[model samples]
Target: MEQQSLWEATANERKERQALQGEQHCDVVVIGGGFSGLSTAYHLQRKNCQTIILEKESVGFGASGRNGGEVLTGYIGSMELHAKKKGLEAARQMWQLSLDSIDLIEHIINTHQISCAFRRNGDFHAAYKPSHLDGMKREQEVMERDFDYKKIKVVEKQDLHSELNTPFYHGGRVDESSAHFHPLNYALGLAEAVEEMGGTIYEQSEALSYRKESGKVVVNTNKGRVIAKELVIVTNAYSGDFQKTIKKTIVPVESIMIATEPLSEELCQDLIKHDRAVSDTKNLLYYFRLTADHRLAFGGSGRSSSKRDQENLFNNLRAGMITVFPQLKNAQVDYRWGGKVGFTQEMLPYMGQLEDGSYYAFGFAGHGAAMSSMAGKLIAKNILHEGGGDNPLEKARLRPIPFHSQHAKAVGMMKFYMKFRDRIS
Candidate 1:
């Protein structure tokens, strides 16, 4: 099996760019070249701003390329929970922003003419238990009545077989606004668009540190230095100790995925009749979708330990796939890979300027494809003195994870807790 992302394997030719070799200056410097950073640069360049992107690796080498490519519509948590934590109006705004994020993805694809196999085929939030279906119904009602959103259709258990050819799911809900696409292609296309608009991108240019000097932020890198009026941190899960506080704010969880060899057209049609992306209601949930090339791309939250045995990981994921689609028990796994996802204590993403005047947006948990792209544009608008501060996430207090000092132990405990919760629920 290829030890690479299916998206990367199928992507078009990638544009090569030189690394930062000397001192540079720009209006803003974006660290990381994933969706958030690239999208931020794209928007800023369109506004005629001088922007510089510093990536430790090639553009889209991080979660931007490694994700499941589900363009979902909502935060990690439910709208009801958000409303209780914040207010009803605030939750409504957040939901509206999520819907807007989906629109932004479509806009970027169309304006850039990105041939990333973008599709609005919708998504299935499958229920593992009867209670999960009840929750879906309640959520759908709340969304329709309170937020005036009605794209979701609740599928009863009796009608579940018509939507999915699996008895594993009790029922589910369908959100037609959601989409799936080739993630790497879209990221590369965004990079091309950024360069076309006069933005500078430097690969293998890892940012070492940053400090304010003469009313400007000077970023020290491995190969060069960058001085800019503002800075944005878009590293997300790959964020190491670049900023100590930011690192503590999120727990990086490993997500593993495997893509099966192209199945027969009849089998693919039988597997997912509507070609809709699917995710189940479980603590360590399984998400699967029919790739543009007719392969089954299945993924899930892996073990807490980072040093996972590849063979074991593949076996576990294959078993999960077989549980959902028994016919896939003998299918050959073509690709197996893993990536990290940043999860916040609140289980939602946050975006705003930091105390040091450096902007940041991270902690998407597992739902980031659309949100990160939208965050990039919003961050750019905020830097331009536009009305981008209205986002409710800006008001959230960034809290570090409990027992973060004992990282490994804490994560192990978290994994145990989740497993226990899943068992009881």
Candidate 2:
């Protein structure tokens, strides 16, 4: 079976951009052509900043296009824990920012008329165990009492049938503010918008290294170089050795996804009743949603980085899907793909200027679709002197993770521990 991304296979055709040639000068140079870079270029160009985007591959070839298409509107970790660590006031601000991220995506799609099958159908956080439902109840209460946010509704085990036809979950919580979309198409649309607004993008042009020269930053690629007043590194998981400091601060993990052949409309409705994206409460969570063509797109933690592991990942995802919805027992998987996700020590996203005087953002965990786009806008504001520095995310520093070279082994051990705990609990 061939491994590919459903998003890439279905995404609209985009005009090919030639690799950078000779030398070019711009007000800002954004590295990586994923959501963050494209978004930063779009926002900067709208403000008449001479911006150029350098992409190693075609646009959206990285995590931005290969993600699970979940436009979630909150933290992946516990909200109450976040409130306890950072004062309630700080937590409140972060919560609002999360909501604003989703809003920005909707605004961009509407403003640029992006045809990415965008939908605000919300999402469901399922309880893998009976005790998990109790935690969800507390989360709902905390959001209402402390954050003044009450959009979440908890479904009891008895009432869970209305949401999903699965006995694997005991209950779940629904967040009406969350959404889903065709991520690759969205990224392509932003690329087009950036060009329309006078920003130039070069495909197959990777930033090999960069250095500060005088007051400007000089980025070098194999074919050419860019000299700009400012540089933004949005490479995230693909930042391999390009910047040692930033690379040390991030742990890149792989995530695998599979898309099943299109099911009958009736079967799709039976599987995901309300057509909302669904994720389970587990250390290695199971997230799945219905595609526009009625196919089930399922994803989970990937075990290894080896290309030979693709078959293993596909089997794992298919088994997980069948466990949740036995009706798909014989469903044929049409596509299988994997992408890297950046995780920080804090397990939260961060954005700020590095010691090298370059702006950067990464460690979105799995929330890049919404958070990364917001990071782009914030980075643009920082460049334009628009008070973006006031945000909490901008104040945090990306500290290097100790023993960074052993990330794969460490992640494997952690996954083993988490899986054991999940089984016992």
Cα error of candidate 2 at position 176, Å = 0.2
* Model 2: residue 300 alpha-carbon error in angstroms: 0.3
lDDT of 2 at 262: 92
At residue 307, what lDDT does model 1 achieve?
42
> Please, what is the TM-score per model?
0.95, 0.96
Candidate 1, residues 115-182, lDDT tens digits: the string is 99899999999999999888889889988998898899999999987678998989899999999999
lDDT agreement with native, every candidate: 0.87, 0.87
TM-score of 1: 0.95
Q: Which residue segments of model 2 deviate by more than 4 Å?
A: 305-308, 404-425
Residue lDDT tens for model 2, 1-425:
22579998898988889999999999999998999999999999999999999999889988999999999978756678788888888889889989999999999999999999998999999999889888889889999999999899999999999999998999999999999999999999999999999999999998999999999999999989999999999999888778888888777787889999999999999999998988888778899999998999999888564656667777877998899999999999898888888876676887888887799998888889889999899899999999544577774556677663656534854565365435433
Candidate No. with top lDDT: 2
